[model samples]
Target: MKIILKVLLYIVLGILALCISEMLFFFILIHSNNTEKGNKTVIMKTDSIAHSKALVVYQPSLMTDSTKNVAYDLAKGLNSKGYDVTIAYPGKYLSTDLSTYKVVVFGSPIYIGQTSSVLNDYIKSVNNLKDQKILLFVTGGADDSEQLNSLEKLFTNAEIPMKISFKYNDKGNENKAFNLGSEIGKE
Candidate 1:
């Protein structure tokens, strides 16, 4: 009976050690991911909006809602400049004809170093965009050079108004969005 008890105790100790090690590993991984975000050098440009009608079509991050994203700030900035901006999530059924807008802004969150598939599909579906002015922006935790290159290649005729990658919990990027809007509005 004593031998059985000793074995049971040893088993319990071993299980406890395994659990502790797993927990430590998970904690370390989480810490490292939070501490190390890759290079975040996102570059963008904006052209003046000659017409008042503007549409901001965007896809929110998987982890964040539309209100807490750079797209929302970009729309707010455009609105502040009196561009008659309409912000819509690309997943929704929109009654507005995208081609009618004088300046169309496309925003997306970079996932796995690329733009989400939904945004890509939405862009492809839009028609009559050859003459319309286009603006593009992306949000991500790190510099998404691959995503930018892919998007630039895809939207060969579109102008990249601004490219910004904001880290988690960053609130200071609104000014950049506002400035981009102002630059567009000025023209």
Candidate 2:
């Protein structure tokens, strides 16, 4: 009986240790992102589109982040190339008039192996986008092929130029995102 109690106590302690470690990892990821990037507020400014300008739309995940987001990374990239950029969240910006911007970037993270609902709705709402450039970017862990393929199909059907889909890592890859944004601005 004593041996059984000892084993039970060991199991409980093991579970507690696992829980603590998981929580620690989560806290680290959140704070790491915050430190690397400043505030994460969505910028909705379109008043400066009279010059070279771009709009980036994305929806951040719960417990994930908005500041260290792939969308903001690309926006920063665009900024590096002298284009005025505004990054906005889909829930707030979907119905916005996008006629002034020269370039529009749709960015989102794959949720449950699919494109996020907010992003999908924003994409559907876009109309009369003739001659204006449209870009698609998605961030996700591991295989995003299914989400990528679906996005490509949507772009192909709409006759929009299909850019690259960025696979998201926990640690944001700002350089790659910046390169893509710079290239878009040059075009």
Candidate 3:
């Protein structure tokens, strides 16, 4: 009986140790991901609508849900110049009508080396803009530029009036992209 109890105790300890290690690993991963996403989320509600009067739709969507980091400086730059801005992600609402917005900006994160399905659907749904203006802004890492540039060409060829910009892992790129947003608003 003593030997059997010892074996059972050893097995339980091993399992407990494994569980603890797994929990620690998962906790670390979740913590890091949250921190990264938190920094990006700072751009949300960044809509300074006083600059440009155009509706700005910034979407950061995975296959799961769509969210956005509002380009406040970009929106503000345009709004400051007197453009009205309305911002949203697909998750906020869906099947949105583009007819109401004269100038529309769609901001998307790079996914699988390309834009998300939500942005693609938005572009496809926009069949008759007549005189509507469209702009696409993309956020991605360094190697993503080639992919982003190519993606921008797709939007431009489709008459989206894209001012393609890429945000590398480096923070400065986002600022650069923000400046590009200003140009996009101007155009």
Candidate 4:
């Protein structure tokens, strides 16, 4: 009986150590610098000169390309609707002057049920978006309703007409994001 108790105690201690390590790792990741390595902006403009303008700002995830793919797909959809779309990464280089845009979209990847600080900081820095047609998107492993709610709360100052959560493994996520962008561009 004593030997069994010792084995159980060791197992519990091991689990506790693992949980602590995971938490530490998460903290480090969240606080680390997240500068995107590639091109900061991708423009998708229509042929017409009278096309409306749309902006998509997103923080790409290091673990997966899901967020970046969704942003590009969304831009493509907006471009199809005759809107000049500019897809950008959230950073110092991105211009916050959104006066010329008819529509603005912000996207982030959910990690441990929270959006990245880079996106949150960028959103806070931009001003005068109360009347803008703002759309939001988040990519994660699951569609957690609580996370969506929190994301909405983060953008409470803006008029978010549409907000969506895309699961990483979902096959139809790209199409869904594109459709959402197309719908928003029509407005």
Taken over the whole model, the C-alpha lDDT of each candidate is 0.62, 0.65, 0.54, 0.81
State the lDDT of candidate 4 residue by residue for 4-111, as single tens digits. 999999999999999999999887656542444344888997986779999999888867788889999899888988999999888766777788898899888887
Clashes of each: 1, 1, 13, 0
Q: Could you arrange the candidates by TM-score from highest to lowest?
A: 4, 2, 1, 3
Question: In terms of lDDT, which candidate is strongest?
Answer: 4
What lDDT score goes with residue 108 in model 1? Answer: 71
Runs off by more than 4 Å, candidate 2: 1-50, 66-68, 154-157, 170-172
Candidate 4 global lDDT: 0.81
- List candidate 3 stretches off by more than 4 Å: 1-52, 61-70, 145-158
Q: What CA RMSD would candidate 4 show?
A: 3.2
Q: Candidate 3 has what TM-score?
A: 0.55
Better of 1 and 2 by lDDT: 2
lDDT of 1: 0.62
> By TM-score, who's the top model here?
4
**Candidate 1 residue-wise lDDT at 172:** 70
RMSD in order of candidates: 9.5, 6.4, 8.4, 3.2
